[model samples]
Target: MEHLKTFLLKRFRIKDLGDLKYFLGIEFSRSKKGIFMSQRKYALDILQDSGLLGACLDNFPMEQNLKLTPTDGALLHDPTKYRRLVGRLIYLTVTRPDIAYSVRTLSEFMHQPRKPHWDTALRILKYVKGTPGQGLLFPASNNLALKAFCDSDWGGCRATRRSVTGYCVFLGNALISWKSKKQTNVSRSSAEAEYRAMANTCLELTWLRYILQDLKVLQTVPVPLFCDNQAALYIAANPVFHERTKHIEIDCHIVREKLQAGMISPSYVPTRFQLADVFTKALGKDQFVTLRDKLGLHDIHSPT
Candidate 1:
């Protein structure tokens, strides 16, 4: 960057900021204890502007077992407003991953959202209203093992029948990356979908592990990749395959090779302790709160 800057802006005045405190719409605060990222002020402003600052909040971001379908009967008269609102919420996920899945799911119906979809978006806003200060926290830790949890909602989409792939990566206890996207291809079985999800997560995990190694944080001890499906775990552990999983894409099998070579170890975790469950589906209030607390987030009031 210095070399390029010298070439292009040779005579331009520039101030050298030693460290990055904030960038790209995220505010970063570092202290001796830990690093914290919050959009508290921005979230509050958005809530007030959306007329949800005083609304009754729901326990969960979205209702469980709710399947959204195409709005065939009587589409919304003004979907542009809903689309714009959801778009802003999508950007808010930079500091607020708690609403990632809900925002992503709501963003899917941007074209012709109905009243139900709009209400779901409003419900998420209401939930965010009550918890505007929620954000990611990174504690100072020497243990930098790149742990990842990958899961998929098998045939979760009601209209397209496409599964949802969700994953979250942790640098020790700090969550650095997460995603909730609809699968591009139709999967035949749940195991196949999960295998693909793990494969995608492996791509990210491998890249992050490389970057961390470059920064000399931790030597890549076989990254512990957790999944809840036994069949998918077996598929990653063993190279052989039966008729059920043969049709899965070859790219998805790369994680198997990584496992065999000791780059990563696929482990089975029960759904109760699965943190990735929050990203893949709409969870109940108890489960959501449990996982949120486990993510190292707390109410940081100063000497209350």
Candidate 2:
């Protein structure tokens, strides 16, 4: 590391910056255990900007089973505030996957945010207030095996009736990538929605594998891809296609191609053990907390 710095210093006008304590808005702390990353300062700035620094705290980011449509309430008179807040919240999801689903939902109303939408956005801020220092931890471990959990909420969107895809990828015990996104086409069944999600996860895992290979981390075994839907697993493992899967032929091809190439191994996991559930829907406090802990989120500033 020092040699590279010396070579760069000879040509480029760059200072050593010492260590990676802060970069962009992310703050990092290192110890023997591993590294902990958070955007506490940025989170507080958001709360203060929204005039919610002193607001009451919320236990969770969004209400369970709370569905917000584009026309849920009266449109905002001035949408600049709503748009700006949601934009910032989107960036905050970098180290805070706990709010990914809420931010994704709130982002849909950027064009014409309603009063309920604005209120829901502020509620996410309240949840942030409760644990500003909460963030992801990369434990000091040598395990490089990759595993992922993918899930989908069938016809979750009340406005468009589109399914939502949620997935999380882990490099060993540490989470490396995650997403909560709505599907473009409406799925005909829960199995199709889940299969689409599996395809998405396969793409991510494939990309991560290339990245790991570039970093000289070769994966010896096929990465495990967990899903709660039995039908989806069968579809991926089965080479023969059925009439019901014709609509999603492209998605089926992608997952099956990867599975055949030994890039991923699809497996079944129960709904309760599906860590990606928190991203697919607004879960209750108990489930949310349990999954959050499983994701390795911790508040460094909170009392131990």
Best by TM-score: 2
Give per-model TM-scores. 0.90, 0.99
Predicted candidate 1, C-alpha RMSD: 3.0
For candidate 2, report its TM-score: 0.99
Candidate 1 has its poorest 10 consecutive residues by lDDT at: 295-304
Residue 295 miss distance in model 2 (angstroms) = 0.6
lDDT of 2 by residue, 175-259 (tens): 9999999999999999999999999999999999999999999998999999999999999988998899999999999998999
lDDT of 1 by residue, 79-98 (tens): 88898899889888887778
- Specify the poorest-scoring 10-residue window by lDDT in model 2: 14-23
RMSD to the true structure for each prediction, in A, is: 3.0, 0.8
Clashing pairs in 1: none
Best by lDDT: 2
Model 2 residue 179 lDDT score: 99
